[model samples]
Target: MNGAVVEARNLTKRYRDVLALDDVSIRLSADRIYGLLGRNGAGKTTLMSVLTAQAFATSGDALVFGEEAYENDRVLSRVCFIRESQKYPDDFTAFHAFKAARLLFRNWDQAFAERLIGDFGLPVKRRIKKLSRGQLSAVGVIIGLASRAELTFFDEPYLGLDAVARQLFYDRLLEDFTDSPRTVVLSSHLIDEVANLLDHVIVIDQGRILIDAESDALRGSAATVVGPAPKVNEFVTGMKVLHREALGPLASVTVDETLSAAQRTGAARLGLEVAPVSLQQLVIRKTLINHPSRRVPGGDAELDSMEATR
Candidate 1:
């Protein structure tokens, strides 16, 4: 198989007057974890749908394993997409769903699926329709993990899950990833929660890719400095200030530009406190500040970011 697992070439999608995606192109490799991030209506969902063959693009092409993904059995069989609101027949119990999954997925691990079901405290006989939102999410998680597909996408898989349950999911995912590496794309609103799990991140805004880089590199790309208003203002005068906050004499400003050795020394000399910006905060500022004219479809921008990526 080719090293490039997912490839999009000038991908575009439209819904009536709205351009859901706009000439977006990206290349994702295998055996790595990717974070698909963007505000609501930024085309994150449209892009993933096109790549996974769940939905067609209005223009351009998407390839999975070097083959057209749309209705292509060769490519589709190796992929699994777990939607946030995954649907199961009203009468279908978790046990029945797993049985179906076992028949469909060549790599399905029944033992693993059973263990996950126990860990999540999901009742085998309970019909899917009777499960709570959190339990419903757990079913999707179990299927996605146990399917063992070479390419798996988890689109906001932890909705309504408590902190403890969410942590368990992350722990299991990381452990399994270490044992058997595959391409895993996670779309989540809890940026800080999954920040450490991602090797790479792709951020989209207004249907355009705004940032695509290694997670570590992105973390180091921006810095925030705080000090007296005048000094901070002087220090950030020519830099790309992404956001700024002021409380009387104290001022804190986040800059998009990386700091040089000379700049670091200058900040120290000026008695300015420099700190790193979290992925979540950076994304919020980027999407909200840069595109204020566009309100995220969902009231919650973070939730939209996670779901859109799915």
Candidate 2:
């Protein structure tokens, strides 16, 4: 929990002709909540599986706590991976699952688990198969929150949950995290919802790293300027523009660099409005990641690429 809680070197997973992870290398910091974001089939789950040793990599290595995760009791016992669709045995009830959690995880908090169970309104005596989808998701969320592992990976663990329930999960997570700081990673397509929860972000696209940076830094890296076309052009000169929209004499452009105070003043003088882009829009405009990129750019991220790479 001091240094890198998880590290991968040239990690790759190939299922026949399909490439799941393409020589991806990353280091997860200790005691930080990281958002592992990407589109579907972007290898988010693949990366998690490799790191947690739930599945073997075709090539390269994954280390948990500076040691290989595969078959290492010392490492595995301290890690918890709750999948989006968790499967329990036919006979396993929610109570049975809790019992299993208590046996497997050394840091399992029964009282905390009970609280989460009540918060989620899970039926403890009912069979896992009999629970509704939201309740099923709650089972995973409950285990994940209560397990309190040194390294915990939640792979979209809130499917089938209503907006209110999802908000509850987020509130509970942040509240509990304040008391027990640990290495946590959340993989989700609900980017904006978890934007505030992330300390850092790592976006994967087509089995490759797209963007890896601190959340605040990432949020501050882009701005949208709207005004007369000429003034906008003059203000954004030499800056990277990710997207642009124009109507008659007016224009609005999304730029990769955060506006300096002087730049803001200049924009104000030019009658241009500079606005911060939302994390969702930032990711979308910055990467254009949702469309057409079969191969990952094998290079370091730069402001210039915020538009060009798309």
Candidate 3:
């Protein structure tokens, strides 16, 4: 929160028949990890591209390090952008990639890179084309971590890595970040996995910024209460309900507001089960509420319609 490392004001991007980004404004502070979350085609990649100077926005401005990022060596050198599908020369190997990164990034650490190579069990001699998808992803993850850039953007860095490898990446990232605090913006579909790693969260939906808030503030912001339909309905009567469903006589309702200690006790008295909503659940609820077309066959819309009749 000391100063904004990245800032976009009323940003908009359109591609002929498609509107990729729409009037989005956001700011990223230094020395913090931000979770840039959204479903596929939600404009996450488009926004990152615009900010990194890889893609031009049809309208508005994208500023990095207090200046436009395009063609600015001073700015770009201090930043690292790792894409989900990073391509390399067919003849090149992980060794060549690391060697090139060392020269390009001023803050690149060879020792750190070597350690990460070992940690990921990456084969340096194997040609880039000969490596598996998981191994290729490992190369990118290693570079992103070892680059030690002042600002880093990891757009789905854990693409083909298995569960253990993904967790390893998270562990290594958190450990390294704690030692050398820098700004990191991670865009991943696995919300719950990275939820704890984020200091701030930004959720995009349909080219719009649906959520931009401190991560801690979002915890306990919503709760799910389960009980008989009548009791559940009465308990959530004056609250902002994000989602609700009925299974025969039992109704489970998710309210957007937090519950106090007394309120929790009151729910228990009514035999209502109160559960904390995870980050994933909250994001899903919000996204579905915003985009009706993206819902499943028997999703929120149908459930709400059924509730209306009751």
Candidate 4:
């Protein structure tokens, strides 16, 4: 079995009235790409902050490399956290940021960073504050990849990037990760885009752990069924249903169990449509089931609230 590179036990955080993190325990196996997913205010950022020592835990423990992470220079230097709004000095340019990272990170690769700068077309001479949002994000992505830290956390790093730019980031990260294997935890709202890159998936909802399992196992855990309401209902029995929607007589429902061979045969015989639930669909349906009344009119989180979650 793989050893835990990151571990937390009964971790909780409170910010005034907001209970940011509930009593949550989780572990990330070393040298793997893990997806940290959740809705806004799901404590995803809070959990990362506690693990990275940027914030304190109200209770329980957070350990990195079998040691407490807070104020621990040895552990801190080996970790890199690049969020959407990572701070840089007013005088700092993209090159300056890379230089700072090279000095701080023990495993920094200057050549890799330089190549990424070219790939992203980042203005090395331009001040960090002057770069566009996507360009600024590219700077962070370059650092996160080239730093080659033992543990890296990227919390929604592509805030204003277009599809082409986002795909470039994904491509470069995937390629670099294969060459330099390390533990990475990426948090993103574009679940489908990064789903393929994840070896493990951990979902947090309402300050609590909702789903934590191997990505392969999670993909096979649930399925969606679309057909007539009566037939879909009759075909799905002895299975936990996660969510359901009705369009006239036609119905669409997601079930919380893999389709057995017999179940698949039955569904096919009954002229029902049985499809595998995607990682994004599974997460969305689960979140909806968890909060029945709170509906997201659109899938975009930025549209709902421009304010950043603390």
Candidate 5:
């Protein structure tokens, strides 16, 4: 964990029969935004919880700032963990939450917090229990941005935010991050929304790391080949086919390989259309392809189920 802001070595978390994190190891460098993405119960929350010391790993190490995070004031003070269902005292208001955060996080910016409150139209005087779902999420977003912690973990920080509010969060996050870079680990089910904000991505599935690579590298790492069934199948013969759909004689096959310029020209010559796979599409295909039980017998009924949950 020498130069890493956060690192986990063979981390495992098991609750009797359920294994949340299965021998997971990862290294997160400093001053970069990372997307910790997965489906509904894919150990994203468990990983963050262990890293922040909110929950202990059943085995192995969880380090932050080059030291074990549990009960380490020097490490914990520079870290902020804003969970989806963050709780506050019944009597506490948004103002009180900010006050507490300011005292907890040494780099807290009160002025920025005030500006965010106004931007979100949050009712600072309203009690935490009295605020609407969207307002509650806004409170968390404000604290996460204004805290300015060196290591921040935002676990579904846009839980109740609408499309507009979510966009505002992304805009502010990128703007502030450009001015003052920090290590940010964002775990969200909305992969497409936060895809552009991430420098690196670590996708988890069934308590294991499915894909961990730079975001730029992953963008065009896969391609879809479409043409007559025979030629399309031949084009993707040696490639790792992620998915395949057939409509009469036409076959569109998604392959997990970066095609060369010559390959693209060859496909065109063979009357095949090559299209770049989107980040969202790639993630879904990889996840579903790796787990066939989640798919319906002949269609994507379970894929639809997964998307609905997201």
Candidate 6:
């Protein structure tokens, strides 16, 4: 509590020939929400695994509350990791699973869990194996929110949930976060969907840190300028252009720098439209243009097309 809630130093993990994580280092504080973002197989899961002690780091250190995380009950008991494919015993029902979670998590809030169950309309008596994928996701979401651990990680906990259910999860998360602040890390492919909720954004590509900055700073980090083709081209000549679109006499160019005050005024005078880049668009442009191969840390195949789009 006096220092970083979680810290990783040169954390590395290898699976045979593949390096799932490679010399990754990060420090996370308590009472903040962190967005753990990356395309599929970008080592997001592997990183989380090592941090939570679910898996060991190949050649680095992971400390939770200043102590090694692996098999450390003091740290593990205060952390809750809700995975997308969380499994419950075949004979257990949703209620039974909730009961088990309540017992495991020292900070579990029974009333909050009950309310989440009601909000998600989860069937308490239905066997875990009988629930649909979305329903199963709802169970994970419920536990993640109700656990109220000092540090909680939600790794795509709403994978099969519909838009409405997903929205509900976001709403509940935001509301609860405001009321009871804690360290929360959300790992998801729905970048745009959760962009607004994130206070900090961490982008990983090919097992490397691409960008880690305040959400607002990232939003204004770049801007797109649109104007007549020749004018736009000339204006962006010396700047780092992330993307471009041209149509006859019109062209739009996205650059990796904020325009200076004079430059902004000049663009306005020249009848050019300037707009801040969205987090999703910025991330897409960076991953696609900067690292086209999109390999993970160790030579994993590129993330699928759908993941790239996210």
Please report the candidate that would top TM-score against the real structure.
3
Residue pairs in collision within model 4: none
Alpha-carbon local distance difference test for all models: 0.86, 0.88, 0.92, 0.88, 0.90, 0.86
List ranges where model 4 is wrong by over 4 Å. Answer: 292-310
How high is each candidate's TM-score? 0.92, 0.92, 0.94, 0.92, 0.93, 0.92
In model 3, state the lDDT of residue 285. Answer: 91
Highest lDDT scorer = 3
- In the order shown, what is each candidate's alpha-carbon RMSD? 6.5, 3.3, 2.9, 6.8, 5.2, 5.4
Q: Give the TM-score of candidate 5.
A: 0.93
Candidate 2: tens digits of C-alpha lDDT, residues 12-111: 9998999999999999988899999888898999999889898899999888888988899999999999998888999999999999999999999999
lDDT tens digits by residue: candidate 3, 233-269: 8888767678888899999999888799999999999
Error of 3 at 251 (Å): 0.4
Candidate 6 global TM-score: 0.92
Residue 245 deviation, candidate 1, in Å? Answer: 1.4
Instruction: State the local distance difference test value for candidate 2.
Output: 0.88
Superposed Cα deviation of residue 230, candidate 1 (Å): 1.1
Higher-lDDT candidate among 1 and 5?
5
Q: What is the lDDT of residue 83 in candidate 3?
A: 88
The sequence of per-residue lDDT tens digits that candidate 6 reaches over residues 188-237 is: 88898999999888887777777788888897889999999777766776
Name the lDDT of candidate 5.
Answer: 0.90
Give the alpha carbon lDDT tens digit for every residue of 1-310 in model 5: 2268987899999988999999999999999999999998999999999999999999989778889888999999999999999999999999999999999999999999999999999999989999999999999999999999999999999978999999999999999999989989999889899999999999999899999999999988999999998898877766767788889999888888899999999999999999999888999998987685755565554544343232
On TM-score, who's better, 1 or 5? Answer: 5
